[model samples]
Target chain A: MTTTTTTATAPPTRPVVSRPQERPFGLIRHSLALGRRSLIKTLRTPEQLLDVTLQPIIFTLVYVYLLGGAVSGSTQDYVQFLLPAILVQTVLFGGMATGVNLNTDIGKGVFDRFRSLPIGRSAPLIGSVLGDLIRYVVATVSLLTTGFVLGFRVQTGFLSALLACVLTIVFAFCLSWIFVLVGMLVREPGGVQGIAFLVLFPLTFGTSMITPKETLPGWLQTWVEVNPVSHAMEASRALMVGGSAGTHIAWSLGFSVLVLAVFAPLAVRAYRRRT
Target chain B: MTFAFEAEGLVKRFGKTTALDGIDLAGRQGSVLGVLGPNGAGKTTAVRILATLLRPDAGRATVGGLDVVRQAGKVRRLIGLTGQYASVDEDLTGTENLVLIGQLLDLRRTDARARAKELLNDFGLAEAADRPAKTYSGGMRRRLDLAASLVGRPDVIYLDEPTTGLDPVKRDDVWTIIRSLVGDGVTVLLTTQYLEEADALADDISVIDHGKVIANGSPAELKRVVGGQTVLARPADPARLDDAAAVLAAVAGRPADSPTRGVVAVPVSGDAAFTEIVRRLADAGIAVTELSLRLPSLDEVFFTLTGRHTTEEAA
Candidate 1:
């Protein structure tokens, strides 16, 4: 009897504190916090890491051993050539996880909760984009480690090789916004995955990944020349191996800036309008 | 007095179907305003508009004197939303979900953690705080969802059918939580398909149907809107039904209508009249096989208002 009375009389705990005043730079802060959530969620589900970690290593082994002799005279030369394209290719596909995860997220009610919060509208989108930087880093490190193990050497210094990794990561980060847009409009995560395949396969394979551009048909060579993915691959290759990298670096940076400018706004707009 | 939140002449359409048709709603500060309706009666569309999750095609809505569309960010500071689906992140732990919401509200990391702990303890989730929300029972996930909404101490909160699909015991827990939130003087906009829930928790109830509010009043007033209750009496013999109707009419202060040949029912003002019917039927020597006073269910109310059976509402 006394227990019922005691329980009824006890006050409910509401530790919620109000900070009605708007904070400056809230975009950066909120994005960072949401990004932390993505990181934690990813860590808890280690299988999600298979795309970044496992894919790169497997692709490197297959290409360097299977196609290495056919593409180049020796497995040694092919491994060096394949490593740069493989890193860029892996991270570019790694960007798909961002969209697929987001598509799955929006299908649930979590995005509705985020939308109702006081954070900046684009914070969740940008935060997931930032949080996925881990995937790119993992792919780069895994691919490079596998490359070194197979006797593939970077002729350029360590700093230039590091710059090449940075370039590919930045390009992938910017490229992810397009997938983010797809995630927002598409009804299903499977649809996002489908579009990712439709977009990525041609873009990655159409590049001079396995063979030299000069050996391909004239029309194909022209595409490899203009393709942004090819620019990123060529930029990384030139940076890791000794070459005049200024033009390729400029084209890669320019493509990253262009994609970010066009797709970031579109993705954010789609998110706000999705409901 | 200015409302804690208000929506006026709000219209929203998805393709050719209008989800909300020029509806208006308002809730007083520190009180519960129940938006009672069946499924797809525009209750959720209305809540989403007020929560600033969905923009209305027409009309202006405000929360704490700020426009929902123009000043959405400011309105967000004053409001929290809980939907029928648990909105807490399934991948995150209970503590992590609440803490993330806290951090989004700009609380320092330490403060966010402390607040998350407090909420988890209060919601009876402290024991499972470290576990991912996916591992939580349905009730535990709902608690964490509610906890996530409360992390910022919003002045107004929108609960969109919060207890839908819950067991009775879990529902009672949610009701208790809602009552305590009201006790803390937070304004609430609670939508539910259950009329009893609205009557029990709402200071004012707005009865809506097909995207329009058909009635609005305190629970008692809304109850009376559909003629309150009925003094239903069934005759032991079909031949004696006329006498039963007369007895019911005399006691209920209105002419009784025979819904079926075997029974006569007349809407009564209160339960006190039910006792009068019992007394008068005995005086008249009328044999009633069944006699009772019954309150109107939501289906009955909708039937009375629109002359439409709520067959789909039940679905």
Candidate 2:
């Protein structure tokens, strides 16, 4: 590729596909093709949809009805306060399936089939992430619809609400790399679930999703301020409910980039090592 | 001339266990090389190395003259692998599985679909092409697995114990498919524990045991190395077994073996020995109900080569 000689430029005599370098955007092409497979798998198995669809609706219902009064002083105020953060939490939870499904597939023939092909080693991992991106979108729409039904109104314009949805998905997509790394290293599918829950509970719960930052004690308040999940949720709430979201949005995007930078390489490397 | 695929001094170990210990295997262009061995004897390990699934600790392997390690990507482009367990995506229908492979190979979407349809029809999976592979029978699943590999139309293929668990009829179906692949000038490296499978398909047989090549030759050559053609005679009178044995032994210049009740069989190096035995048996006034001459079975050759029966080790 550095110095293309005449022989290199000449077409191959064999009808077989040329070298990997010769195929432009081979990574993206293969990854999207695999992503379509994951999407079809999702469509075929309706039960896997329950997490993105029902979990958000059920969580919104129970949270607004049961804990809404005690936390926000009224169910009405709580729906507005809780729904946006619920969108953040639900999408993050839905993202967990990427790792779980990947871990399950590693022991199956499907993973080997992907690895044996002459494609990018990271295609399967990226394809799974891309395929699971829909879950976050589903959670966002489902939670937002439930919120609107429960008397939550968007103070911001349509553009801002849409921005919130996109931001929530981006943050979730970034955070899923951590689970993908775990999935690559862990041997058993069930072990992936156990570790995912262990990491996710603290990451998602430590956020400012349930209550305002002011209500927490000194140490917890400071931790929430630094937590990226808290920033993502904060940015989501502001964009949807109307507030100064400039700082939160910057923090969320910055943290998302940082997490993706650190973990995406690590996950793909772990995949190569594990396989 | 270079072989279609070859492995020289391949050595691989897992912790304390040596899975493949300097095994040499090769397949000529447009022919089959059968790596025959019992379970844990490293047939699969050797195959994995040649398929670029595993790297040999010390050895050189090439497919169509491209080094497996240094040019693994290029190797993948030229080869296909079908594991013992059919590796088709069970969730997808047969058509989708093949189409997925086609797309991975960078075929146009319409071309991929057309290829899938053709392979499905060719493999007699047309009716089940729309059904998820998980629902297909075992034989159908194997056919789809094979079809998936052929999507790229590779010149060399590695079938690692491709018929390990299949029934008799299903195994024959696979053998026919392999024959057709070879008919198209594709080279095949087949591994199997079934002696008959190798005998039926391989042009060359490499008998492996405990990660080493203990014996290597054509089927007829390996049988000759172990011994030679055997002449058998069943006495018309069960009481005359000893007389028949003595007559055959004298003519062949070796002691005859009574492998079964009332049947005396002796190893003979040539057809002359068989005719001599017939003349001698008649001279001794021995009437035989059955008489035949044949090469030694691969089962016996395997036993002679390894000094242990496959059934014993397999069990």
Per-candidate DockQ vs. reference: 0.40, 0.28
Query: CA lDDT of A132 in candidate 2?
Result: 88
- Compose the digit string of candidate 2's lDDT tens values, residues B1-315: 548988899999888899988988888888999988877889877877887877788999998788999988878877888987778888889999988988888787777888889889889999998998889988899999998888887778888888878899999999999998888778899998766788789999999888999998998887677666778899999999999988888877767777679898877778898888888888888899899987655455555676555556642
For the predicted complex of model 1, DockQ is 0.40
Candidate 2 deviant stretches above 4 angstroms: A1-22, B227-299, B311-315
lDDT of 2 at B33: 92
Model 1 ranges off by over 4 Å: A1-20, B227-268, B272-295, B312-315
**Model 2: per-residue Cα lDDT over A1-275, one tens digit each:** 23222212232244333222335688898999998888888878878888889999898888888988899899999988888887888998998899999988877866766777888888989988998887777778888888888999998889999999999899999999999999999988788888989988877888778888788899998889898888888888899898889999999899999999999999999987774
- TM-score (chain A) of candidate 2? 0.91
At residue B1, candidate 1 shows an lDDT of 83
What's the lDDT of the predicted structure labeled candidate 1?
Answer: 0.86
Q: What is the lDDT of residue A99 in candidate 1?
A: 95
Model 2's TM-score against the true structure: 0.87
Interface RMSD of candidate number 2:
5.4
- Give the share of true interchain contacts found in each model: 0.68, 0.39
The number of the candidate with the highest DockQ is 1
